[model samples]
Target: MSSIRAVLFDLDDTLWPIVPVIQRAEKLLYAWLKLHAAPVTERVTIESMRERRQQLMASDPVYQRDLRILRRTVLLEAFADAGLDTRLVDEAMEVFSKARNEVTPFADVLPALENLRSRVMLGSVSNGVADLDAIGIAHYFQASVAAHRIGCAKPDAAIFHAACDALGVAPAETLYVGDDPLLDVEGAQKAGLRAAWINRVEIGQDRVLPSHVTPDAVFGNLHQLEQWLKDNDPLTR
Candidate 1:
């Protein structure tokens, strides 16, 4: 492992549990649509919208990386069918974006960031749209690379390389910490960066890790990760 000069993070599950945040955002978005776009509301519930989105994306996979465009396409199609104005699309997105960024990070996040950021450059690489700046943690990061903005997502080395390019570091000198085994650990490894899995998900007795995925290290939380970095201070290959 080369010395880590910069650290990149995955946004959603790695810092804050994302399921509830996204659910709440969707609910709020639907409510807003119902109020402002009654024609659309008459035909679609949140469930129906989700279904339509899946169907649309299934037929056209390019929107998978450009989620904002994907979502806008879904809304435009739905609105056209409902005889509503497609111009409201941006407003609807603003509603969803606001709710999406209303996240509370895990207890360990702020503290660990305060510790490590002064010592190393920090950046965010995420497939999600959550805005760390809106979430009030933007000060901690030097740059943010998102799938929608970068034209690719995790598991692709290009996105990781983009973050390293922004931070002026090589992949070998960067550390990526994330939660998902394949998207985070294996993705970082494939990108030629050291990876640390923040193993926060609780699993049942029968739960098992994917056998093919390997990580440079694993920690239960950012607190433990911080400690590991301290122990391996000036960490090197």
Candidate 2:
């Protein structure tokens, strides 16, 4: 086995439950719109706005890669459609971005990170706009690479390579841990890093793995992962 010298983590579903974060942020953004951009609230419901975002994501490749731009574009279009001043776009984005960064990390996340960091270099690579500083976990990571900043999303090897490079480690000596089988696992594997699937949620068997993509390790939580590394790889222990 390649001795693991560093570990790169996926921020969203791996470190925290992202569904609730996005849902709460959407509600907060809509509430802000209702107050300041009343005309926008009149024209579009929250569900409609979600549909619009999906449509915009489908319409362009950049939208799929950069969530902040996608959301700002949506707000601009909404304000323009309602004849509201576009200056409010920044304010509205602030409301959503702040809420989006208010994520609650999983219970096991900190402990695992503390244990793992002692044994190896730690960093993060995310496709989302999660701010590590805002989330209060910035100190744990030696590097944090986001797709928006790099102009490429996961499932593309560039983002993974960027994270490895930032950590001063070759991909062969690093392990990538994340929740998504295709985007995180397959992407890291293709980028030449060992990959571990962190299945925090209960996934049905049918939804587990793509036929051609198998993770080097799979665990239900980060604590389990730490234990697995200790049991399977003496170097990590």
Candidate 3:
């Protein structure tokens, strides 16, 4: 209910739809594999590669904690499995990483962000290994705290606290906006900050509200979010 001095965002699904972009990136990676790595190309299909990556990731708790390392680990294993050079994993990962950066944000994002930037300090707190600079949105944030850099992931209070620390603001004075109900909303609230749910998908689930975690406000998309910011009640509250 106080004036929000800063706003923290969740990357991936919050900023842009992650599923489609990842699918496209993987498709591209597989095409490259088929063309360049003949041994790997013959041994594994794209679906199998994805399955292997998931299985390998599940076996390692550390990999689950940091998505960047997880991605590199998966790529390395895939290369190793195909009897190809492991050293090429890094180069392949670079290509995939660039593909990841080529995301298109929701239509309302730029204008909303442009408007919000002048009013409050903007920063990011992500559980993944996305480099905002690679995505060309680095200038929009004052700080970006990722799990790999901080050595902890959300809904751990330490990670949330670190983001607030980086912004030089107390938890209560900040607003955390994210897509995941548990990880973003509940986690931020537990860390003593107000939270907002960017529920872009109308999944018809009321599970995130007033139960597991109660967000201060909820919006269906960035357009609604922009309108809310213009009204100022959500941010002021």
Q: Which regions of candidate 3 fall more than 4 Å away from where they truly are?
A: 202-210, 226-237
- The digit string of per-residue lDDT tens for model 3 on 1-237 reads 666888899988788878888889888887877777767777777787778668866797676677777777767776788778898887778778888778888777778778778778899999877778877788988889998887888999999899889889999888899988989999999999998998776433344455767788898766676566658655433
Candidate 1 lDDT by residue in tens digits, 184-215: 88998998999988777542112245899877
Candidate 2 stretches with Cα past 4 Å from truth are: 202-207
TM-scores for every candidate against the unseen true structure: 0.92, 0.96, 0.89
Give a tens-digit lDDT track for model 2, residues 1-237. 678889899988889888889999999999989888899999988798789899999989999899999989888899999999999999999999999999888889998898888998999999999999999999999999999999999989999999989988999999999988999999999999999988866423225677898999988889888988888778899
Model 1, stretches more than 4 Å misplaced?
A: 202-207, 235-237
Winner by TM-score? 2
Each model's Cα RMSD:
2.3, 1.6, 2.6
Better of 2 and 3 by TM-score: 2
Model 2 quality (TM-score): 0.96
Clashing pairs in 3: 1-237
How many residue pairs clash (N, CA or C atoms closer than 3 angstroms) in each of the candidate models, in the order given? 1, 0, 1
Which scores better on TM-score, 1 or 2? 2
